[model samples]
Target chain A: MSGVRKLVLLGTGLIGGSFALALKRARLVQHVVGVGRNATNLERALDLNVIDEASHDAAAAVAGADLVLLGTPVGQMGALMQQIAPVLAADCIVTDGGSTKQDVSALFRQHLPRHLSHCVPGHPIAGSDLSGAAAAQYGLFEGRRVVLTPFAETAQNALEQVQTLWQQCGARVYTMTPEQHDGIFAAVSHVPHLLAFAYMNAVLAKVDAQPCLDFAATGFRDFTRIAGSHPEMWRDIAVANREAILADLKACASQLQHVIALVEAGNTEGMEDYFATASRARVAWGQRHK
Target chain B: MSGVRKLVLLGTGLIGGSFALALKRARLVQHVVGVGRNATNLERALDLNVIDEASHDAAAAVAGADLVLLGTPVGQMGALMQQIAPVLAADCIVTDGGSTKQDVSALFRQHLPRHLSHCVPGHPIAGSDLSGAAAAQYGLFEGRRVVLTPFAETAQNALEQVQTLWQQCGARVYTMTPEQHDGIFAAVSHVPHLLAFAYMNAVLAKVDAQPCLDFAATGFRDFTRIAGSHPEMWRDIAVANREAILADLKACASQLQHVIALVEAGNTEGMEDYFATASRARVAWGQRHK
Candidate 1:
């Protein structure tokens, strides 16, 4: 812990930039170096004070850093890991800020060096609709949940170090299996995004549709906000976690069918009861969580 | 407009309560008299300064007020209007905070006295998941939309007065027909709520479901928060606006079927394009609106 001075952040977009800022705010990292494909974005990160320095060279950026954090889209993790694997120091700890965990873990296991016992896969359940380094802000992870899914072979010391870092960033860390993390997120996050995307597409496809954009109230905005996220990133998430996403979709489909049947049958009381229960559950959960 | 002093706010819950607070904050209304069934809520309204006074008698509340605003659930508006119809002054302006417009308009035409030419039916396109007078807060209407659906018979002066009042309360007002308002809201608000309710219900009904609540992330929380809204209110909105609600549901259903077909056919490219277009449209719409 005493020797952990330099930190290298891969993909200096929202997540990476936020991580860099949080670390700096907490004074956990002595120097934060940002790595990204976009040189302009790296410069913007510097201007925004998201990182101490910007570097386009991935391998060189990870060369002597004590901690390396991957904040790339889920799809790019494999290639980025492979590119940095050769240059990464054996004792340097690596973590991620991806949405899905299973694929990222698989990629690390496949590409990362055997001596890199410090490679720990993680996902912070924190984000916004805004993208890029400019959207980053200090304390973005404060009071947010950060889930770390470590493999059985992952070194205890490495896990502890990553967990401690997230704690210092003001995130409450939870540990779960990669499978559990994927399944839960599919039900809660991925499926919701899919539904929003699908719904928006449907609304748009209607030729004579009214000006939905003009008439869209706050409810519509809130429901569709996640639909505005990076399509390629979401596409990767959908394909990578296909089975779990499908399961959640099927569950949603069945529920919709049930409600449709009741509506068709004129079962007003039944429909009311169903909605009432959902409303009560949501209110209670929100109150308790908030 | 100068003589419009006393304001009677019926059903002092979320919309009505917030309106009262906004009016008081802006000093637009000299006195806001709240009328509702719940004595505790009415007392809380007075205690929280959402209303200047409380009255259990709807007729008494409307007797001296220059502006009468119905803030009850849409289904209850007709009955409440009937209860106060005889006591309503000829010169008083009557409006509503209901979501759907057609039923309320029909109810007003039927039950309201013909001498009361000042009846202007309106729907404030803003609210939160929280209900009751205690949840009311100032600035709820800031930069939000309020739709006023005035019939041909509606008095022009009355409409202008109501529009000015809403403007003073910090809302941009739009004009539309009752049918148009209902149709647009069905697509934007009612259908979205149904989807949320149906989605959450489906997750809960899963036979081998994991602990979804424990793992529910911000996405789930945001998407389902409206599901926790007042069941009775939503039930009323859905049933009263059944035709438009069904139309919106069919639209969403057709879109879902298309996605399912593409997924089943292994048309990955088509699915990706579908999602991408939707994502792009939503991102553009959100940016503009925000």
Candidate 2:
């Protein structure tokens, strides 16, 4: 436990609220201030004991805090960072719970240039379709991974503090460069979401789509599960991480083209080998995970 | 209860094994002859009581069978149909559990022209990563959907018998033409498996694939779950349903191209609308399903 006396949470929803609850259970956090745009949500977080107090003004909330966590959408982090810049304590350490890191790193650079060493960029890989402070729970981060991408200017002590906090929240922490993090996540996460969306749109284009969907079984259900993601959030992530996502999508297109040619030419052997490679790899991958 | 005197299963694997177990529990099947190439799997089926007898010869197995189920891969079904043709009795009803119906329909026409009325082509939408006779369960098809694609020459009595057997296994049976079954499944089932294969292959093409796989969470898990499917099985389905699957693949490629254009142009609102279209439809589909 970091023994942090005062901690402020910006955008007290699932991630932030859950963090507060975990640390409170550890007896590490004495006072927590929840800041959010939605007054109803802030009140709920307070009522649910996700925070000791609630405030709409982020800058005012961070006034006497030793630690401040920015848990809003990547799109909203810049404004929040700009708001809390002047009022943050001299030694206050600021970290975030954003999915994408490169843009958040850029935001930190732009908004708090003078507070560079105190700003530690981190992402806790715990997101669900469910949202709101009411969805927060103590064990949300249990056995989950948290990736921290700290810059050269990021103070060693500040990084460790945030790392310790995540550890106390039952998460294993791993550190990587922002570029590597974005590239890896683009291949695995962002690109899959885009493909699922595109696949859903393709099905909707068919004349007999309703019948197709009605007869769809478990495979269709699992493959398109992420296609029902929040549009605004996915759109923001897509636009925010445009370059890496475009590269991933282009790779996917290239592969799809090869597959299309094989199918069009009726190359049974080539198609079999192709499907075999993927299936073997996936089965091997699952075995490793298990 | 059909009280099938002797039911012969051509391939005693997941689908066939489970069906046998379900029928045994229902007391609808008096005896089940499990036929497969693998001796160990046959012994396991017998030990598990999924079948009362085990045999390697398809022709020998069907000699006394009142009901014969061709439960092998679509690629192997034609040969099995040929093997059982000479031995099948005039009153014996023949059905299959192939994923694609048109090819199986063709096999029925080619190998059993004289017995067309007694042949029924069916696809039970129950698939899992687990295989072998040991994975069989009594309730595998309970509350599951079974599509029966009866031909124009199919006898009403034969279709009803097969339908009642599925109902006894606790499945809801649906009737359609073989072409309709192929088209709908091509759009939903076949295409999604191919897409998942393509996506997994794309990730493998990346330089940091293992790292990407390492960091992948729930979204990636569900998205790529079917990628771990049986390679030979999927290849057979893909090639067997090539025409319909090709059309679906083309539509998906077109949708991906459109998404790429939206993303490349950085048209935020356009991208949002595109994502929203897919997200809305998926959510609505899920709601209707629930």
Candidate 3:
């Protein structure tokens, strides 16, 4: 496959900068352009050699680029797509690193309707507590899973190009529909984060919240680690994928209600049974994953 | 302070075996007697040098012992306490390593009424997935917190002796009422565990559970790590600490309900505010603890 002549990153944070670095290391892209509102971050990306050039204007950056990666938060992707639509080349392959696919897919359809054939909405499952261009590294996507959700109008050649690029970055790629991608993420990532936030809030509501926190050990630490995630990013996820997230939250609430009933009735056998099912499945999953 | 002449362990598992090993390393105990129902486990304890002697009979083992540690599940502690009550030495310092203290306090009151002055209930916060005598380590409690709940009738010297021994084992000891210990633990350890179990079960209830599990990444792994805990052990804790666990679980459920409402109403700012509170507090706690 021919390498990208010019690759543009719409937002040069960890995700976009890391992608640029990885592709640069693989020699799959000739020149990289990073576009973001943060001048300091763009300067850091240039200092770190994550991108060859930096630009504040998205439209100008992608004017003649063969590849464009929308690595900003989902909330910012629509305006970015609208800004670059008029200046994009005839076949500039546009993809994104959004956490949610359905929303990004809708944005592609809304702002870049004529460019659907070249747009591939994707999510790279490399979540981290760190951000900014300084957090980017060449191996960030190595061994990570990336899910691509291509709409019906997306060209097969465009999809293959994105997949091959992610492969060059040492990522394992899988393809699914936008709806399937949203639902699966809602189950595994989105809902667990929301649950952790809720659990933390509940602990805070306690009369002895400080003492309770003081006594919290490893179990509490690992369980609520995600509760310390970026508030704006999670708020976007919680609202953007509202229907899927609400369904899982309701299911979790119902499960808690069942647990309460069992505890109230002093049902040792039932409680053991409930816990055993979860423990057994979790243990099996852990062994397999490990 | 003088060392214990002979110490009896009524349950020779991780907690009990680790305590025996720590005391031996400190040269604070002249003799350690491990007693349990499983002959194989007792033999393993002896082979591992975690115990100086092994016995199948708790009553027989405590006949001439100056100290006794009930290092078993809460459900089995009562039976062992009753069995050793008639044989216990007059001034033997009896303590337990149970997770929940209120029930153990009640058991000490009922089974060893005459020995209340010598009884000090303790909980070592060194939880691990591994168990059995082989899993015992020399410094399992080196930097762990050990909470001791000594009743009003407990002799100062007896409590001091237990506290001193734990200090020798390299544990930081804190004293509180049994009720306070249970409530604080329910908020931190017990409820987080129960919440994890409920979350795992909710995931298992999904129609595409396997696919969800396949796609589960780091967040799910950390969030549900405690769900793989021992079922019978957690069941006993849930029942023994029923009132406090139920209250926290209800509060957690209510929090989830509020989150659901925020999502349903598309209240992005409300969601952001709710997440910010938790994220800020958790981040602060992490920094302080680290």
Give the number of the best model, judged by DockQ: 3
Each model's lDDT comes to 0.83, 0.89, 0.92
DockQ, per-model, please? 0.58, 0.80, 0.84
Predicted candidate 2 versus true structure: per-residue lDDT over B1-290, tens digit per residue: 35799999999999999998888888888889999999999998988889899998999989978898888888999999988889899989999899999899999999999999999999999987667898888899988899999988989999999999999999999999888999999999988888899999999998899899999887888899998887778878878888999999999988998888888888879888998999999888888766
Q: Show model 3 residue runs off by greater than 4 Å.
A: A1-5, A24-31, A43-49, B43-47
TM-score of each: 0.92, 0.96, 0.94
Worst 10 residues of 2 chain B by lDDT: B127-136
Candidate 1 lDDT over residue span A175-265, tens digit each:
9998988988888888888888878886786643556578787888888888777776777787778788887787787777777676666
Q: Which ten residues in a row have the lowest lDDT in candidate 1 chain B?
A: B206-215
List the candidate 1 regions with Cα displacement exceeding 4 Å. Answer: A113-116, A207-210, B25-31, B113-116, B206-211, B259-272
Which pairs clash in model 3?
A: none
Candidate 1 all-Cα RMSD = 2.5
Query: How does the DockQ of candidate 2 come out?
Result: 0.80
Q: Which residue runs does candidate 2 get wrong by more than 4 Å?
A: none
| Model 3 C-alpha lDDT per residue in residues B1-290, reported as the tens digit of each score | 87998999988899989999999988999999999888899899999999989988999999889999999889999999999999888899899999999999999999999999999999999877567898899999988899999989999999999999999999999999999999999999999999999999999999999999998988899999999988988999999999999999999989999999999999999999999999999999899777
lDDT of 2 by residue, A60-135 (tens): 8999899999988788899999999989888999999988889999999999999989989998888765577998
lDDT score, residue A198, model 1? 78
Better of 2 and 3 by lDDT: 3
Candidate 2 vs candidate 3: the DockQ winner is: 3
User: Where is model 3 chain B poorest over a 10-residue stretch in terms of lDDT?
Assistant: B126-135
After superposition on all C-alphas, the RMSD of every candidate to the true structure, in Å, is 2.5, 1.7, 2.2
Query: TM-score: which candidate is best?
Result: 2
